[model samples]
Target: MLTILPPSFTLTDDSLQELLLSSSSSSKSWSAREEACYLIFFSGTLPVLPGSHTASIAGQKEEEEEEEEEAQGDPLSESQLTSLKEGLWCPDCRAALLAVLSIFSPGSLAATTASSTSTSTSTTTGAASAVEARALLLQVSREQWKDRTDGGHVYRKRYDVQSVPTVLKWIGGKEVGRLVDEECADVDKIRALVQG
Candidate 1:
């Protein structure tokens, strides 16, 4: 499981171009398993629409109608709203990733081997369990990937990232599943894909 933590930013074409440039030189040595998984961490925001007109009464009426339709539609539940605010609503992408890692035990192996091989340089004091190892993996991955760039931008032309709190899952560089916008925010969906 190799997670690509792209600089945190909204999706945009320019941002995608930047990502292409920046990641071009990075190592792509990670191997793919039958259960290989890649998590794309990004700021989920709706794509900006091009073209605009002066505000008019007709436009205002349209806006009101849309709002009315939304109101009539199914609204987000309390937990969903809280998840959105906490940035955890993207199908619990982070949690799902962690769950998958826990099942695979790669992070656990890496952490244990590193700690046991070099006690003098080891940051952890005692033997770490798989869960702890997974946490360390996430922490280290974030720290390593976070400061590489300023941030990301929303580029809808390539990745259809429609909102800020989105999580995309890929296998062998092909998108197998995703949680974007207000679709099913269940991590089970991601788990199922990973399990497959």
Candidate 2:
């Protein structure tokens, strides 16, 4: 329900400069641009209003739910839906993609983010993980995420990312440590993620 971003084509518009005052932080500007990307995926949608009870979702997740039959997109098998739960809230595919977007802070790493192009185009590719991460999140509703045939399955196999909100500490290209799920939400654990 938050689709307020202007089209990406407007991102470079010279006329829009009038909206910025000198004190505005560049970070805020970047964050604004990023919102446009969130719109590209429907991850910005709130299934039920925030701070309310969680509801079941049916289609196009990074996602929310109600009325599985009324949910948009193709239906997932019970077994398949169960598999997706590890990485997504309610195992919605849309959540899978949103999880990836949540991974690193802007400029936090000299990182490569594999981004799928818009439909009917070639998805961005480079690092094996980039492409893998993109595919996993983009096609949550289209395939069995943990199945051998799913590319995300392959990516997770390499990193051992079995669930959502996993934080990996990669030092010099080798994984030094990791914090999974609830551990990531703890203040002390987050400090330890970098310190211990």
Candidate 3:
């Protein structure tokens, strides 16, 4: 099976671009495709919305609402207030990280063959998805594509990325595909974009 290692983290687009450029042969952009492709991803997220209860139990949704009201009735604890002030509740962002990590959880890239084949042409959609998550590491220059909170980040402004858990696929130093916000939470979608 062909597999790529997970991405390596970088703080700047120039540094990341440089790493991707040199990632393969000085001549290649580093991809499973004959042409070489690279990926940059961002997983940072803002806090959840006020009306969130996406996972609230059916019967307990009302109870939770009541609890929220009750909690408001009481004075807020210092820690509770602090948590409210600084907490980030974006489960999708966490899920995105977990989905990718889950692909790696079974085994490290070092445990696999150094070189292999790509899954972009697998038999079934499901099979292709399963393999591509791992293929993501091998198919592209393995620079970790995580997001940053710096509003002034280079690519952040350039790409106009407004959500967390974003993924960008680049070939020849140009972006070819992207997944923003919750889309990045699905390993299948992530792999599809990279593998596509």
Candidate 4:
């Protein structure tokens, strides 16, 4: 069994790319331990979407009229909300993976992230819109990706990757160019690695 390790930094396209390149140079495949870590870490950062609820239909005039006639009232239960937050309202791991992979799917990451942010904010006030939520989420996201870097931690670590974008760019080769082009990742370390 492989023990997965958290990324030394955020799992950006650049970092993933760099790992791939390094592995390729070393004659290794994506199945390598570090590569597996990247894959697992990437898989976990995916966003969960809320599902349809009684409140959702309540917003519709037709459903409102129908409900009024029936005197029916059952809002989304707290458990349902919890389940939605888990991204487990339904079991669609493939779809979820696709969503995560969409980060590399030309123009899809921005669109999906935007839509996700908007949806999350719809339940809150204007102060909690996608624009604001993204900023907060991005910050939290970065923190989550941060490795434990106390004094002298860098030398203790064998592979010293610091940023997701940087790693992605280094190992991405040609496939991750979309991420680089989108300005979501960078790859300057390849030169450094080569020079050193």
Clashes of each: 14, 5, 10, 10
For residues 108-192, could you state the per-residue lDDT of candidate 3 as single tens digits? 2111211121122322223332442212221111122233556544445765555544566656446688777677656567556
Best by lDDT: 3
For 1-196, candidate 2 gives per-residue lDDT tens digits of 1111211212122222222212134434422442211111111222221111122223433333342224333323334333434533333333332223222111111222223211112322222122211001112222333365545653356556665445555432345666565554343343344445
User: In model 1, which regions exceed 4 Å deviation?
Assistant: 1-35, 40-155
Listed in order, each prediction's TM-score against the native is: 0.31, 0.30, 0.43, 0.22
Better of 1 and 4 by TM-score: 1
What are the runs in model 3 whose C-alpha is more than 4 Å off?
1-13, 28-38, 43-90, 102-152
Could you tell which candidate, 2 or 4, scores higher by lDDT? Answer: 2
lDDT of 4 by residue, 116-162 (tens): 43322222222212121000011113334443756323312323423
* Candidate 3 overall lDDT versus native: 0.39
Can you write out model 1's per-residue Cα lDDT over 1-196, one digit (the tens) per residue? 2222223333333433343334334344222322343334433221111110111123354763454445343323334333433543334443333233222233322343323333233332132222211000111122323333434222333455444334455444456676553322333443343444
Q: CA lDDT of 75 in candidate 3?
A: 29
RMSD of 1: 18.3
Model 4 CA RMSD to the hidden true structure, in angstroms: 17.3
TM-score of 2: 0.30
Once superposed on the true structure, which residue ranges of model 2 sit more than 4 Å away at CA? 1-144, 148-152
